[model samples]
Target chain A: MPKEYDTFVDDLSTLPEGKELILAIRDLAPGNRKYDTRVVKAILASSANKLPEGDILWLRYQRGSLRPEPWRIKIIDEREGLLLKEKVYDT
Target chain B: MPFRDNREYIEALEKAGEVVRVAQEVDWDLEAGAIIRRSYELKLPAPFFQKIKGYPKGFRMFGGPLANFRRLAIAMDMPADSHPGAILDEYHKRAQHPIKPVIVKDGPCKENVRIGDQVDLYELPAPMVHDGDGGRYISTWHFVLTKDMDSDWVNWGMYRQMIHNSRDMGGLFLPTQDIGVMYYRKYEANNIPMPFATAIGPDPISALASCASYGVGRNEADLAGGIRRAPVELIKCETSDILVPAHAEIIIEGEVLPYKRVDEGPFGEYTGYRSSPRMPRPVYRVKAITFRNDPILTVANMGVPLDDADICLSVCGRTDIKTILDNYGFPITGIHLPPECSGHMIVVAVQAKYTNIASHIANAIWGTKLPYPYIVVVDSDVDPYNITEVLHAIVTKCHPVRGIRAQEFAVGHPLLPFLSLEERMWGKGAAVLLDCTWPLDWPKEIAIPRKASFKEIYPKEIQEKVLNNWKNYGYK
Candidate 1:
């Protein structure tokens, strides 16, 4: 069987070269998957401009943890914390 | 205050407490899409992701703006708590008088422009909205603006486009749709590329107008203007002569290569299924990608009920059926495409004045681009909007054989799950009109069965007394 991505690419240099890829900053961790992508986003966005167009590869790192069914994704917190961290406390 | 742009609409949603700002980063690879889908299912406020996982700070996304009737009502400048029926009436009334769009020199979409080789479609985070989709789609909630090659007619339609590479995208342009008519009949036949521009994250009304079952040559921009009761400002495209909504968050201008076909889709469409197969479709060779600084990409999770498409087609598809019937002089009191059926069925309440009126009604609906498989026509006494009334009529009033017409070779949508690949390709299928009205030519003195209800069976005195004494009856 083919392999599945369990963790995000921390080192972009190890990624395969010479093919068009969909670069997504994903985290395979549980609960923190939603927020964990932030550090990876910064990691990729920092170097994305320098990378070749066809070489951008995205590894969809779910690790089969989060809800696969779209309807199963729950929205529990209806608070201002969901907004910008600074703006939530500004006013 | 009225909505003129996507930002204005978001502001309106924020003011109404109908928007949730996701400060936490959401992955575009499916997690963001899941959140958007959940938002629709719960009938919650629009989810505006301020921070996408893969993109920079300014590039945000707004999903399911008109996911509920309340948000839809706000989009149309109506009361937030307006009933869905009244919202439909409001939309239909405004659609009667289309206000032509006004052209402007420059707009927000022109704020940041990348032309030719500078265009990288990946700069905007195109969400892979559903798992197992063929690729990331760029145009889910947007409208494709294309002009008729032979005439001055321009059409704006909601067609999905998937990004193939840095400079190319592909989408399904069905032959039956207006865009397909322009592309296949005029452009492809003549061996010329068709000029096209798509506006993403326009005001909510424009998106609804784009999905409406508009006849050929009926401009959606004008219908949008009519619904909003104000002219939609448009800006000239960079690469093409086609104009796009001025305040749109982003505009992708390109040309459809005449003979070029590319692999596209297996998307989870509005029918709550991946109905359309992954196949070769028309290619959009991107010439320019223009947008406002820090663009807001409108994402539509079109898999199940109460999604953006369902919320829109519920009103628009019903409007088309009712309008077609009214123009043909059928005495229809009300019509509804329930959000539950996802536009697969329509219920029409009518006064069956003559023989075979149900057939006429079915045929009228079938003639439109959006035809429902289940056409339930009941008597004027029934409420088409109420599913219980429609179900009761279908069970009791409809005869075994005579009252049902299982129509073959009816127009079928590509997104319909039941159709075979070949059938969907040819746009042909079967439909059944459940005629629930009593036969007009029946000879019996009391041929029509009595309907028992507070509105139908009870006398004025009894209904009044019961309604007046409801408090004493221990009913709150």
Candidate 2:
């Protein structure tokens, strides 16, 4: 089974990476989730002085310890609501 | 734009070119109030004071934060011009499904720490936001903590804290509020002081949530988690068992002595008037302080429209009123937290699915948790956000005795100006529940024919062309 995060350091950096990656883990969290990713793209676009819909992934961090990875993950868009979800794949 | 904290929020505004930073030093006295008032009158975004007349260079101040409902909406991660009704609906929905806060050991807020004797309140440029104020108030945006009398669940609320001295602070102890009631009960049983902590500049959403009058026993921090979706990161206080935002700018850990009370305010309030005269209130004794480097202080201007007092408190009242009514199963169609009355007046629009729906909604709203609502419920189509429409429903649809209900001796909001006007003014007033639903026997459809209009037979392209080229007709 996939590992769960027991510490803060692991939780912050374990966020899903991009669109394809986020789709796999959307419904694992117990509460409703809202994903806000505009800034990731906006910051990237602003730095380049051009708008290109920069890539920033969003996902819901579900409840449950990482050693057993009991929760699922839900991806969402601020403007569009829910995007996708994926079951925690065991190692 | 998204922000990690108040400092980060301001930084985002500056980066987006939405804010104008004043480099020149401005006095924290009346001068700051004047500048803030001018910003509101001009409908400009709030200003950031990089340099104040007093205090160290790194001590920054923010004024007029969330002065407008639109701005408050933006802070809640909604569109700039979103209506209060829409925002509150979302708030209620989020409250039911809460995301727990994440516990973190360290963050940027720990960059600098001040504990014990080194902690000096005078070092920060906390502004005397209003004239004739007791002293430079520090609690405009601070969260005051008190645990539930029965449960250990912590209660966080944005009650105003006034700076009396480096070691002492005084705050309102209104008997109606949860904090006041809880503290009094503890004092009565223990016959000793109750320890409390005041946190300044936590995450913006958390600060906003604290201002909301969530029902007793429910932790406002959970509401903050709901607002953010992701769990809010929290850190335990160094001096007390209380938990504060890991990223908060400053935390003042203190206790309120059971028998001690001091003169707190003659300060201007949200009702567009200064409270009659000075009065003694409960005092908070500072025992420890923890802060980050170059900490930024936030202030809310009182005594005028669309200031932080209104924006923040209004959201609280609005959310509380709606939540209470919804909890009672009232078919509420909409609710408005008008900036005009500093959110004291609440107008609810109900669908009125059946007869007496208006009266039920009105009574439900009036009897709800937030004490006095000054409620007016109209037909769903009336659009409660439109002052003109709400008034029209009250005037045309409501028959005085049939629609209105009066409540006497009900507790009033302390900030209400009318309270201080008369000798022992009734701390209460009558609430009108306009029965705007059509007469009981009336048919649903209107019998009259449609009025004539120019667009009846016009094609879409032709209508658009006429509108676009209207000036060419020389109508002027």
Q: Write candidate 1's Cα lDDT for B153-183 as tens digits.
A: 8999999988766677778877778898888
- Is model 1 an incorrect, acceptable, medium or high docking prediction? incorrect
Error of 2 at B95 (Å): 2.6
How much is the TM-score of the A chain of model 1? 0.18
Of candidate 2 chain B, the 10-residue stretch with the lowest lDDT total is B421-430
lDDT of each candidate versus the true structure: 0.77, 0.63
- Top lDDT model: 1
Per-residue lDDT tens digits for candidate 2, residues B110-191, read: 6766677876666666676764455567777768877665687778887787766556677775655678777766663576
The local distance difference test score of model 1 is 0.77
Residue lDDT tens for model 2, A42-69: 1211111232233322222221112322
Can you tell me which runs of candidate 2 are displaced by over 4 Å? Answer: A1-91, B15-17, B79-86, B400-402, B420-435, B441-476
TM-score on alpha carbons, each prediction: 0.83, 0.75
Model 1 chain B lDDT-worst window of ten: B258-267
